[model samples]
Target: MNKSEILNTIHELLKNIAPEMDPTLLGQEENIREALNIDSYDALQFIVALCEKLKIDIPEQDYGKTATIKSLLTYLEKKII
Candidate 1:
């Protein structure tokens, strides 16, 4: 998948965890968990959703690499392509 597709997938997964979240207002450098005010469990749920939906593996150690919108997109782009 491409970056746009990856971003859309991220938005979809994020909505599942925080329905109130507005993807448009999310900054590329913003922290997703903090933006959505979600807890660790919710964060993991989002990550798991991304992994399952994208059919990619994001090990626990690399979770930090996905801390922001840009980072996650960058990370996903690399993995997806």
Candidate 2:
């Protein structure tokens, strides 16, 4: 999938896992956990949800690569195909 499609999917998953997060306040480069006020557990939940929905395997070591929307987009793009 293209980055736009990937991004939209990520947004949808984030909404489900973190309804309290205000997308309006988020920047692509901002740290998702800090910007969304989510803890590590919630962050893990988001990652899990993303994997389930997208059928992508994100290794624990690569979790750090997805700290921001921009980074996550880049990581997913590479992993997806």
Candidate of highest TM-score: 1
- Poorly placed runs, candidate 2 (over 4 Å): none
Residue 4 Cα positional deviation in candidate 1, in Å, after optimal superposition? 0.5
Provide the RMSD of all predictions against the true structure, rounded to 1 decimal.
0.8, 1.3
Model 2 residue 15 lDDT score: 81
lDDT per model vs. reference: 0.86, 0.84
The clash number for model 2 is: 0
RMSD of model 1 against the true structure = 0.8
- Candidate 1 overall lDDT versus native: 0.86
- lDDT of candidate 2 over 1-81, digit per residue (tens): 788888888888778767876654679799988877788898899989889888988989999998999899889999885
Question: Considering summed lDDT, which 10 consecutive residues are worst modelled in model 1?
Answer: 16-25
Report the lDDT tens digits of candidate 1 across residue range 17-66. 89987865899999888988989999898888888888889999999998
Error of model 1, residue 54, in angstroms: 0.6
- Residue 16, model 1: lDDT of 81
